[model samples]
Target: MKTQVAIIGAGPAGMFLAHMLRTEGIDSVVLERRDRDYVEGRVRAGVLEQIAVDVMRKLGLADRLDREGLVHGGTNLSLDGEIFHIDMEKLTGGSTVTVYGQQEVMFDLFEAAGPRGVNIVWNADNVSLHGLDSDKPSVRWTEEGAQKELQCDFVVGCDGFHGVSRQSIPDTVLRNFERVYPFGWLGILADVPPCNDELIYANHERGFALASMRSPTRSRYYIQCALDDRLEDWSDDRVWDEVCLRLGPTAAAKVVRGPSFEKSIAPLRSFVAEPMRWGRLFLAGDAAHIVPPTGAKGLNLAVSDVTYLSEALVEHYRERSAAGLDNYSARALARVWKAERFSWWFTSITHRFPNMDGFDRRIQMAELDYIRGSENAQRVLAENYVGLPLD
Candidate 1:
């Protein structure tokens, strides 16, 4: 197969890029190792930053998102027993975030991309990038035991951290900076209404807890747990108990627990590889960086990277200019580091460290207190939380 661009991975990053490029009459092919059902069923964070929502709308993929997604003007921060609201919209002059599932966003993309005849090869195996540093880059994959090859003007690695794209780059050229936290988020998905209207991020002596919802009728909650903790050790009852213990009486009293449909422990990490671009090959989304979910920047960051890359490609094809493409790595990384800092800051303040000493706890408290007491601090949180402009 031959195309203008070859995309690996079918997650939001790859999906968004393919669709965005398609809208510009650019032809591309997507290769995914997973099948359609698996790709669509994966449960991921739903907090869509303002820029992500705008991307969906701009791509003509926001119909279902508009009808179903929840919007939050602010978020709650619970320190000790007091919950202080950071009015994001008010502080940022009406900036807001939409709560929409990543899976739903994929649904929107597939709905449009499929009928338009966008080429996406699912269940592709052993996908490899060749001649990335050369002008004509290509991808090779196995499909139904048959080896296949795709040639493109450029290759995109949206396959994520564990994927092959990043590894394809020569070791000496790539530099990695990473911090893996000692704690992990023990998260659960339940079919019940959330206790609060807005997301609540709670910091307590027991641990950190978050009250988030997928929809009015579906709730998603998380509590900090040891990295070694296993799902077998945490029953539904136990999970709810820990959540309530951390959130305090006022918030806990409102929690209506049901049988959890999904439960998993996600280890937190902050990771970025310098220079997202490697010759004709470019990395976007989790391929280039990863942010802890504390600030809900993971998916949003991916969308933003896709947005930048799409524009760069459009500029290259439309104006026959390489300036945007040439500057893609530096540009994406600039926003990436800002998000990493926000996620790191938010995670540091909200989560309980096993090694947290008295002074550390006090500092965390002081950070939250400042956000609560000072309008300027709240404005910073609001702007970063709602997301700084994609531009």
Candidate 2:
């Protein structure tokens, strides 16, 4: 098969890229290793920055999101039974975040892109990338025990961290930066009412606990723990007890019980692969970088990367100039690093360290206090939380 661009991975980044390109009269084919059901059902980041919401709205993909997604004007930070709210709109000059899951976003995009005649090849296991240095780079794959080759002018690798796209780059030209935190988050989704109206980020001597909900009837929560921790060891009773302990006394509210899902742990890490381009192939979304879930920047950052990448690809097709495509790495990196810093800062402040010294603990407390006490500090958090302007 031949097309103007070959997009690997049917996740949000690749799907959105294809949607945008088609709008510009460009043709692209999306290849995915997973089936449609799995891609649309995977539960991931739910928070959308103002910039992300606006982009989706402008693209006509926000109908369902605007109707079903919850809009939060602010979030609460609690420490030792004391709560402080960061008014996002007041501090960020009218910016707000929307609570819409990544799965829902992908579903919406898939629906929108399908009718536009975008070709999606599911269960296509990518074998290799060939002819990257040439004008036409090809993707070799197999689907249903049959080999196939997709030839295109440019290839986009949006397959994410574990995919083969990143490996295609020569080691000498690639620069990798990574940091693996000492802890992970044990996340659980329960069929019970949320503990609070707004998301509560709590810091306690035991560890960090986040009170988040997907809907009025379903609640999602997380607790910091070892990377190798297993869920089988922690029963439902133990999970609730730990959540209550870190969250403090229920007071007017109470912890509701329901069928609790198995706990899953995600190790904290921040990673970035330099250039984001090798020859005619370009990387987007998780294929480029990853941030811990603390700041809720993962999905939003992926959206931003594809937004810039699609625009650049369109410009390259129009002007026959490589300038836009050439600058993709530098442009995307600026926002990526900003998010990395924010995620790290938020995680460090909320999670207790195993080797945390007295001075370090005190400093973290002081920083939190300053954020709650000082307008400038609050604004800093608000701006980063709502999102930096997307160019």
Name the lDDT value of residue 86 in candidate 2.
91
lDDT of 1 by residue, 248-318 (tens): 88899999999999999999999999889999999999999999999899889888898899999999999
Model 1 stretches astray by more than 4 angstroms: none
lDDT of each: 0.91, 0.87
Cα lDDT tens digits, model 2, 58-165, are 778999998988899899887755678899888887888988888889998888877778899999985689999898799999999999998999999999999989
Report how far residue 195 has shifted in candidate 1, in Å.
Answer: 0.4
**TM-score for every candidate vs. truth?**
0.99, 0.97
Residue 283, model 1: Cα distance from true site in angstroms: 0.3
RMSD of each: 0.8, 1.4
Give me the displacement of residue 111 in model 2, in angstroms.
Answer: 2.2
